[model samples]
Target: MKQIVIIMIIASMLLFTSAAATILPPPDLETQGILLTTDVSALGIFSNNADLSWRHSSEVLDANLNLVDIVWDPETGLPVVDPETGELIEIWELQPEPPLKYDSASFEVQMATVYSEDTSAQYGEIAYSKNSMVDTKALPASMSNVENDRIITYTGLNGNRILSKENLMLSGAGTPGVPSALSTTCAQCIPPGCTCYPAFCSFVDTGSKIDMSIVSATTSGEVRNLNKIGGGDGERWPPIPSVDGPAHMSYSIRVAELSSSQPSVGYVSTYLNLENSEAGAWCVGIPSLMQELSINERKSVDGYVSLFSNLVNYESAICR
Candidate 1:
């Protein structure tokens, strides 16, 4: 019962408020101070109730006796169990619980949005605020390296409506290299014996079923072959130039238009002669949105669209 009383007192400290006590009030001076025992059982009593004792001091006088100072262990709130021992002794103390750490990211976006309204004043105040930039860092130049390294590769159905690996094949002797120049023969691989017409790198809107075309034209065909993929051919191609190729290959590929709606989807359209085994205009890094549109469309609108969209997303994600 005594131990229960001590626990109840400790528990009460936790509640914000407690109901009026119906239980009897603790003993007062009129009842005389409790005489604590030497045994641990009696010490348990001091541990529970208000077992503090008082010593008469030369302070002030009460109604019938001299006023006394109620004593407690100077180090702990608890009273010592030994009644006769006058010297102060230590008692076990309880520590208050620590407060929780708050998360700032949870509120950063909302605060930033509001700050944008009144740029100078509001932003200045935010800057002066305590630890406003905690955990955030300046934009790093090497995030580009991280993004490139994080490029995810996907493998499934090559997303291209026409000229996809599924529907095209090569005609020239082995893959085109140095002296060979780039060339390919088109055939509808989807339906065996369906002779292909001309090849188109991108989409084409034809009113009816048509044959895919195949042609090859390279301005510096004999000059830009490096790494000897095409052997010591005509003038050695000049370092397989990039988009603004010093010497570019312009070819018209005939593509089948199954439907005007389901457009092809992929990356830039260009014949790749990296490996001698597979040489054709293949998409880079997983198929992109470029595969669906015509080559002209990809070069014009799609190029700008990709560039601007990437810029916007990058700014939003990192600049703030």
Candidate 2:
């Protein structure tokens, strides 16, 4: 009898263990109380009062990606929130993740500094260090008269914390678009004398509820009458559609002077001409960018529940 009991107990334990293992699904967004959807319109707005209940759900299961906190200085570790004013104050820096480097041929990334304007803690200002990453195709298709202008594209904050600003612009000045890793090698990459651009974006506040907007800019500008470029339109350029979704909108920046000849800011006056080809025609601006980066306030899977929990908890403390 005793032997039989022992065997039964062992069997029960084995069953429980097996059940637990099977129940442990893969890392996913749905397990975190979210519905993974590429539809940007479904994500809702970036405002604090915006309602996400309609888009909220607890069903996703496959994890798409993961984000890790880079870490901060002990001095910068402890966060400061003005008790009276209810503001957050701390030092933040941008660092790029692997598969992407500041001087990669694909894209260049650099960290930027963000400073609070007043003690109010409601907003802040940011400025780049003139450093940039120029890729192999350093110059965008729209670039004219400049051969060294490279255009590299990448994701993530690149170690630089996003300041409490309303807008951000990442440019390689005059070079071909290269991979994110080799962005810093070309002679005319950025910083004038340096081979690449330094860090520029940072901050992990997906809670500040800043709003989200994603923009894909190309270098197809009309250089009409001067030399008829062989392309879709004599002056107008062909649109490069985004594969991500309709939520992903693209724009074109012309480095042309208001006039045909003179250049401003060492480059021609830059202009962002937006296209209306997106599925939902979603808008891309500073506020929109914030929302997208915030993971659309969605939850994570059971495996990644801890990460999402930590991020949410962290945001509460950081954005206070």
C-alpha TM-score for every candidate: 0.11, 0.14
Candidate with best TM-score: 2
Global fold similarity of model 2 (TM-score): 0.14
Give residue 249's error in model 1 in angstroms. 7.8
Give the backbone clash total of model 2. 83
Model 1, 74-151: lDDT tens digits are 688766666575644443323231211112110000000000000011101011111011111111222210010010
In candidate 1, which residue ranges exceed 4 Å CA deviation?
A: 1-250, 254-256, 270-320
The sequence of per-residue lDDT tens digits that candidate 2 reaches over residues 248-286 is: 111122221222222111101111211111011111221
Model 2 residue 292 CA deviation (Å) reads: 25
